[model samples]
Target: MPGETVEASAGSVATRDARTGGGTAWLLGSELLTLFRRRRTWAMLGALALIPILIAVAIIIAGPAPTGRGPAFLSEITNNGLFVGVTAILVAIPLFLPLTIGVVAGDTIAGEASHGTLRYLLIAPAGRIRLLLVKYAGAAAFCVAGTLTVVVVGTLVGWLLFPIGPVTLLSGATVSVGDALVRLLAIAAFVTVSLLGMSAIGLFLSTLTTVPVGAMAATAILAVVSQILDALPQLEWLHPWLFTHYWLGFADLLREPMVWDNFIDNAVLQAGYLVVFGALAIGRFLTKDVLS
Candidate 1:
């Protein structure tokens, strides 16, 4: 009788484990689809696309840059329109770009909680960690999508409006049109990687509040504060630690002899931010009360 009771209890525990332990991939897929379907996602992408178009048109109408005022890329846009696209991305990455990521990432958890869907999601067998991963994946998808919008639109608009061909590197070496395009792709990837830190920070903030607006505004404000601190001469000691300090380092990618030092630092720094904040979000979410 004792042996039979122990066996029966073990079997019930096994059954419960089986029900909750699998299907992680399916849950991730469903969350990705839901993120992609949101109207706000599409609208944010559309707005981002307009930046490159406006840059190309303005450069075309204004004639060649005087070479003394605007960015080095702008000065060369009249020579090869490719510069227009790259230039647009450079402009966006510092502020407008991260703001978009903040909007999406900040809303990841808080939005659902605000609308009372988070409790229902937690009621499933997917558990807290799995749900958080799905949320992070959705935010990461938005980062890639937002960067690609600028890249694709910038390239096409530049091609249609100006000469498209071989490009002269910042180091004075010439690269084939094909090579230049590849470099542009690398630049876009770099920009996307740079935002992962912001995404992580935003998601962490989202876990702190049920109000999506508060999360979104707080995330953007933190980014702004970091940038401002990075600018202060007195805070030079803290530059290396600031998330935005190396954001513009993608410029090194365009050099004839591609420099990897700053680029690598940027990636490593972002990865660090992601790990720290992602852990914080998970730890807090695990203990957080979810009555909504």
Candidate 2:
């Protein structure tokens, strides 16, 4: 039954490809639709959007958090509402952000398999490689969307609840609201890249089994463990190697001149993980016996 559907549909798939000129755009679009159409995707996104709202509301009620009382940018929020997004990003990066990403990426392949649609997808024109790439692309899109959800919502909520004006950089230099917004976008980009490594890992894990939950849990756990290792002073040597090492380094983007060192290093580290884990996922998926 596993290979039967693919075998039977191979000819039809080829015919469809020939008639349609064999474009992959449709497959990718369909994948994205399938991914976002599910209620789970929006639920996770909604949860992420709430981080900044709750933070802003609590700050309004309780007054400015005592100096050094909360996340790095929290104290600044009471002065300039713009920092709300940054602070929310800082709070979520440790666990919440990755948690949502894990749910999406882990469900990439395993969810389809569990639903018995994987075999049909692998029939022809959308071969193993094409499907894998489309799946990864969908997951990556979610990363960007998820990050922006928190950022945009935080910005809006902060503006409405508190006074917004010039943003002071960590270097004590002031920048206009427009410039600060550009920096916020840059920070969001940085956070999106930071999640790619985890997405790739989740993709690989999804290829290993049909249980989406297992892959999702493993991906989130790995993120937490990486951060834990990054925190331990004893593991200083290992810190640079972990994908999460430079997560909070987005703070550098807020400096007067905007430090690019951590940004470059983080991109390179995440890229390495992406390549390694992406290859592993491809290998496993190509050889995997689809019996769902």
Top-lDDT structure, candidate number: 2
Q: What does candidate 2's lDDT look like per residue over 43-131, in tens digits?
A: 89999999999999999999998888878878888888998999999888998999999998998888777766676567545778877
- The collision pairs in model 1 are none
Candidate 1, superposed: residue stretches over 4 Å from native: 1-22
lDDT (Cα, tens digit) per residue for candidate 1, span 1-292: 5533443343333234335654766666666656666666788899899988988888878787788776558888878988877988987877788888889899888977876667766776768887778788889989899998998899999999999889999888999989999888988888888888999999999999999899999888888899999999999999999998887888788997888888789999999999999999999999999986
Q: Report the alpha-carbon TM-score of model 1 versus the true structure.
A: 0.90
| CA lDDT scores, all candidates in order | 0.82, 0.86
Clashes of each: 0, 0
Clash count, predicted structure 2: 0
For candidate 1, the per-residue lDDT at 252 reads 83
TM-score of each: 0.90, 0.93
Scored by lDDT, model 2 comes in at 0.86
Model 2: per-residue Cα lDDT at residue 96: 94
lDDT of 1 at 1: 56
